[model samples]
Target: MDYFSQSIKQAIRTVPDWPKPGVTFRDITTVLQNKTAFRKLIDAFVHRYHDQHIDAIAAVDARGFIIGSALAYELNASLVLIRKKGKLPFDTLVEDYELEYGTASVELHKDALKPGDKVVLVDDLIATGGTMLAASRLIRRIGAEIVEVAAMIDLPDLGGSDKLRAEGLTVYTVCSFEGE
Candidate 1:
């Protein structure tokens, strides 16, 4: 791995059988705990996006907010949040998607984007791709164009990145873990 990749990998903590059996979860709290590592993580993203004509940063619910908010501040772009169903207070655009176990929904406010707006979707990680895909659809349904989907870590073995690419969406990640 490259130096940056190695650093990011070292910053993450791997937990075994989290929330289920045989699941190796890539926990990013360690990265957040380290000021230098967290800055490095945001700096990598900011460097790539600062020069781009990005109108907004839309992040998936929960962890996505952590990275997305910081990135929005760095890039001076508007921040939009995609949250679980009924989480938003105002009128929302909802998209239902299949999770590994069953169905779930996410919501984005109706006024989050304008037509033809260029947006970058942010998340902590991409696993099965369902959540990211749903976030993309929500952004698109509001008439914004997705420039790319950005994540801190990607589990290629899960096929999430490939699935997003198959739909012609660009996926960018700072580091990747090969297997579960």
Candidate 2:
């Protein structure tokens, strides 16, 4: 990792066996709580996409909203929310993806993006590649082009990043945990 990535990675807190046995969660709340770290985190993203001509950020639900909102402001782009099914009130497009245990769906307002809009999909982390993939599909269904998929942390051992790449989507991450 580069120096900036190292700094951001250090700000993350890891919880062992979270929500299940043998599972580790890389939490970004610690980074969000630290003013300096949070600034650096946002700055890193701004520097990367400032010149990309991005029209909007299609962020996965919850945690992704935090990063995407700040990034959208910095990039002077719109923010589109991808939420859990039924969370959106407007007409929506839904995509279902498989989790380790079951299937879950994500939704985006049908009119969230215009055709040909350039978008970056943001998320807190990439573990299984399901959520981001579903969000990307949702964006495409609206005829928007996905510039890339961005995340703060990647658990490569789970093959999320690799799976995304195999689907022809560019994946960018500040840092990665190889073995979880």
Candidate 3:
């Protein structure tokens, strides 16, 4: 593994259960709190697509907002937020995605990205891939081209990358829980 990638894997904290019972939440807060690790992560993302023509970054809601905004600044690209329904203040394009137990929705401003804008979608982690898929649909609705789907970590056992790959979305992660 690369230096920064290895550091990120070390920074991930394995919480047995979070937000519910029996679900292990691989928290990234530890990495965020460590200045060196966090900078390495930011640099990792910047390094991957530094030469790509990115017009903006479509970052998922809540946790995604944390690094998404900073990433956009690092790349000097526009920031487009993919928020939960009723959260966006302007006219929006929303999508409902299915989860194992239920369904939830996400919304993006109608003007978040202009037609033909090259965008990179980012989020903190991918567990089931529902939220990111929903965000992708919303971005496509507004006519933005998704150059890549970037995540801080990928939980392959949960089928995150497989599901996204089925839809032809290329996924990149700084860390993986595939064998963990």
For each candidate in turn, the TM-score is: 0.97, 0.97, 0.96
Model 1 has a clash total of 0
Tens digit of per-residue lDDT, candidate 3, span 1-180: 888899888998899867789888898999999999899998999998788889999999888888789889988999999999999888989899998889999999998899899999999998889999999988888888899999999999999778888988889999888866
Model 1 lDDT at residue 78: 96
lDDT of candidates 1 onward, in order: 0.93, 0.93, 0.90
Global CA lDDT of candidate 3, please?
A: 0.90
What's the best-to-worst order under TM-score?
Answer: 2, 1, 3
Poorest lDDT segment (10 consecutive residues) of candidate 3? 16-25
Which regions of candidate 1 are displaced past 4 Å? none
lDDT of 2 by residue, 22-97 (tens): 8888889999999999999999899999988999998888999999999999999999999999899989999999
On TM-score, the stronger of 2 and 3 is 2
Clashing pairs in 1: none
lDDT score at residue 50, model 1, on the 0-100 scale:
88
